[model samples]
Target chain A: MPACPKCQGLIQETDAFCGHCGNPLAATDPDRREDVFDVLTPTLAYYFITLLLLGIYKLTSVFPEGFEGIIVITAIDVAIVIAFWGNYFQSLRPLFSLRGLSLKVMAFTIVGAMVGSVVVSVVAKWINLSIQDDVFYSTYMFQDTAYPFLFSTLFIAVQPAIFEEVAFRGFLFDNLLKVTPGKSTVYVTGFVFAIIHLNIISLLWLVPLGLALGFLRGRYNTLWYGMVAHFTYNFSLTVFEFLSWF
Target chain B: METSSVDSSAETLACENCQAVNSATQKFCSQCSFPIGGTKNEQIAFRSNIAVRTRMLKESERHVSICKKLLYFLAGINLLLGLYFGFAADDFPSMISSICVALLFLILTAWADRNPFGAILTAFIVYLTLNVVNIIDNPALLSRGIPSKIICTVLFVGGIRSARQVTLQREALEKLKAPGIGNR
Candidate 1:
């Protein structure tokens, strides 16, 4: 015999409810409880931290240059990913399992990324022709230096591919599926992903990209395929820019 | 102590815990001090009655109150916007629509406590219709329209959850009232 957790009344192992207090014993069941860093918690934490960092960026003006600001923000995002998922490494292991990471899905994601990139570029061009502003191009264009191509590949392509996938697909996507039912989880996650970018002009492209990534993550149940797709999209942009295709 | 009985031929009730025979009118057993004559079904029914009362109280105090507050808040915002557009901006069509929608939301809020499902359904229909008309009139409202659509989706989902809960509560109450059910 053991004491009930709520009222400390004597209870038998077979009992489903406390005899003395009549409290349901199901609340004490381990399977019913969720971890502190569930999907919603991390998603919310990411936004709260990002907003706080944005406020700091505005107030302090510590990183005056745009590139430096991006780097600092990316660093903060990485820190958030680590802080939230660090303790629950065991639970996250199943999300990255080898059985779920199929080569077919990987190839599909790569093709999807290529098609998505082309579509985005065409849309961006059309919008640019109408507006004649080239907001994205002017914002992301790096100075033509000796190592400009390498710099773009490292920071713009690889860094975001790894870090963003880890945060969105690996951490947030996996946890969201646990809480939400059906394909809506993917859409909701994508919505949050796009909103965090905080750029109205980019939303036109980012939202679709996010949805595609979310779909892949849910379909394959692994983050690696998403990383490949994201990397290819970013790297292709860098290559296209180097070739003066845009 | 003297061994006395109300009557030798009178009915005797047994205690559930100790099985001690006692008078039918006695509430507790003399031997075990446990409540007599109350069967397990009666206890279950008693507990369910308490649960139903508590759930009803909670639904009214928390869920319904929250829905009413949110409706009123949205109504207040719309009213302020209507006044601004009517007086300051001088946009008559927009102002009139805003005022009408505001009044509708306020009425829905007042009705929510009595008829939650109706209020929620009406509010959703009115809001969606208004937004659809406004969007048709001005396509440029698309940028601002997405956020409102998202909010309405959330409200719709909340309404669905509330409806499910109310349905479950109503079913439980009906079961409690059924003859020969949970009667021991």
Candidate 2:
């Protein structure tokens, strides 16, 4: 009649460790939680390697130019199109709970992003730092190429809304908790998530974003909270860029 | 280190809730079914497994992009050779060969439109064709080489960069669709 405390799976009263999750249940001790700093280094390093390999492959080819670059970049637009489909899967994915989504979570996500961005904006202002010169529009390529408003919208909004949420919130945050038991995982995972951006200049802003996303992930137990927040963050930038306000 | 020391002792001492004992090595509480310890190592092993599977998935998605790039590189080479023969041979046969290479390049481009790497190769072939055209116009076209070289450099570098992003995004999307297995 006992439920396995580890996974909430049904387990016989005679079992010591959870047969399903392998969690040690007999010991009257606190569960050992692996620090996020410990697990993060490898994951972040792997991410760097991924970026390096991708950059090398991208820079070496001879292809899109003039109007062609637009076409090729539009190929990236394919990701946003798929992001639309991800919405459907989000509801159906059993592991991800949608029930936690409430008005409070939505408000928290927006407030978190806004607060994070404002802090970042202030820090950059304090340091007299400039926005990354050639990041969005790379210098070597896409110089004359205009990233159209629509494409930019897709790039900023849907792409990060889906991908970053899935990676930082849904995957990393969830997985880290298995090692580092307890609610404190939200903080540890947040720090690691910020580090993965690998842009120190934006670290101040990114850290809060990480914290907010992690909070939402834990609070709602749903990936949608993070996704919605990420979308809002990106969409704000898009609006700022559109208005030439930044 | 101190925290872990404190944690282990606390677990051994705390008896707020009673659960059936399984064994010293056993991880689960027999009656209450609560995990007692050693969750970190287990999660690491599980995540490592996930990482390996994700790597395999990524490699599979990259297969198409790798093929397209190689094809593009080959098309560029063929187009260049055909152009060289056209000028050196100075005959109708040479011109026909050049035209044939150009036609082949076009076919490759059409095929590549749906593929990222193919598009890049097609662009290179076009850039080379421009050079071939210039050479045909001036048999001794050494002076115009500098300008042609610049165009080729831009086309080649820019095309690949664009294609790579496109392919990466495609792969990311594909990965997101595939459900995480073994978690259940």
Candidate 3:
């Protein structure tokens, strides 16, 4: 005797239907097919939203000047993501979990950020010289300000560190990891992060920085370390700009 | 001897379709004429056949979904380009045609999500026909139409593959719903 594939009822060897449930046992066997949509839906949703926002920013003349624009855009981005993926946020709670941060981890994050800042600065200097173009900073906005140092540091460094880390390393990277293979997840997320910036000149540096941040997020299984690194990178540049070192 | 005879008769095959009992030696049910078997080997073979067909149907559905998603992305791109060309281009006829084709692709994309085989086939035919007419009207479009033709070719092949799988799955389902077999 054979068991029915659907109702699990025992039937004669040549029987096509289940005796108990009257189900077509041969046709109703379980389908174990895996669809990528399970992963693609959220990932694509995030990217599509981001692209749509970028398009709006390009086309519209409604945005405010200077740091206000950045704040408005970041706020909108956060709001859109929260609204779009409200249900999924609960599952992503682990990525944002700050409970496990130890003294050792804190020290590592600080030291790593400092070291990464120096290395990136050196590389950026060389690239800037080779390309014969400025490092594409928005320091011009602060040039005529009452507090150039404070404003630039706040706008260029802290804002991106908090908002971008939450968006890219925290949300986008985690969602991408679900769909992508373990080895390629970091690289793919990094590429997307760099591309989203839409700066060909800064791409050379942004790509590696994105990769480093992605690596930190994956290795430590948290977003704080990447945020610290990002802040350090941007803060270091701001400090140099204030001191006129570059 | 009586107990042993009763136990032997209890081993008689039952019809899955009609629940009619038949003797162990019978090849088919007496009440419903449904097929029945006695050997363990036949039971295993039947189970394996069902498993294989089920797996094939699932795999086909997955492929169709993946292809449909790709087509949706392409359609979106086409729509954007059509909008840009429609508003900005000086060539009135070409711009209108481009917008119409893009709208058609968008409809096909939505349709593909539901009926991939039919939608893909229709898109393939429409694209091919349009390209042929354009080329006959103005041979200059040969250069411009190459990409469209290639895309249609790919869509046509994908549609054929999806259609074949859908047909196979439908046939299997029909077999399950035949006179003696119940619907799953």
As a whole number from 0 to 100, the lDDT of residue B116 in candidate 3 is 64
Tens digits of lDDT, candidate 2, B1-184: 0111112322332211242333444343333333444476654554465465466546644544554554455567766776777777666556555555455455555555555443443344344444544454455774656874775555554454445444444333332222342211
Per-residue lDDT, model 1, residue A29, is 33
- After superposition, the stretches of candidate 2 with alpha carbons farther than 4 Å from their true spots are A1-49, A53-92, A95-97, A134-147, A182-188, B1-184
- Which lDDT tens digits does candidate 1 get at residues B1-184? 2122223576876545444455566543433233344566755665566476556735734554565666887799889999999999999867866776687688777766666654654455445444544454465886785876797657654663564356445534332322222222
- Candidate 1 Cα outliers beyond 4 Å, as residue runs: A1-39, A54-61, A129-141, B1-184
Worst 10 residues of 1 chain B by lDDT: B175-184
- Backbone atom clashes (below 3 Å) for every candidate: 0, 18, 0
Please list the C-alpha lDDT of all candidates, in the order they appear: 0.60, 0.51, 0.61
DockQ of each: 0.06, 0.08, 0.04
Q: What is the DockQ of candidate 2?
A: 0.08
The DockQ-based CAPRI class assigned to model 1 is: incorrect
Best-to-worst TM-score order: 1, 3, 2
Cα-lDDT of candidate 1: 0.60
Q: DockQ of candidate 3?
A: 0.04
Ten contiguous residues minimizing lDDT sum, candidate 2 chain B: B1-10
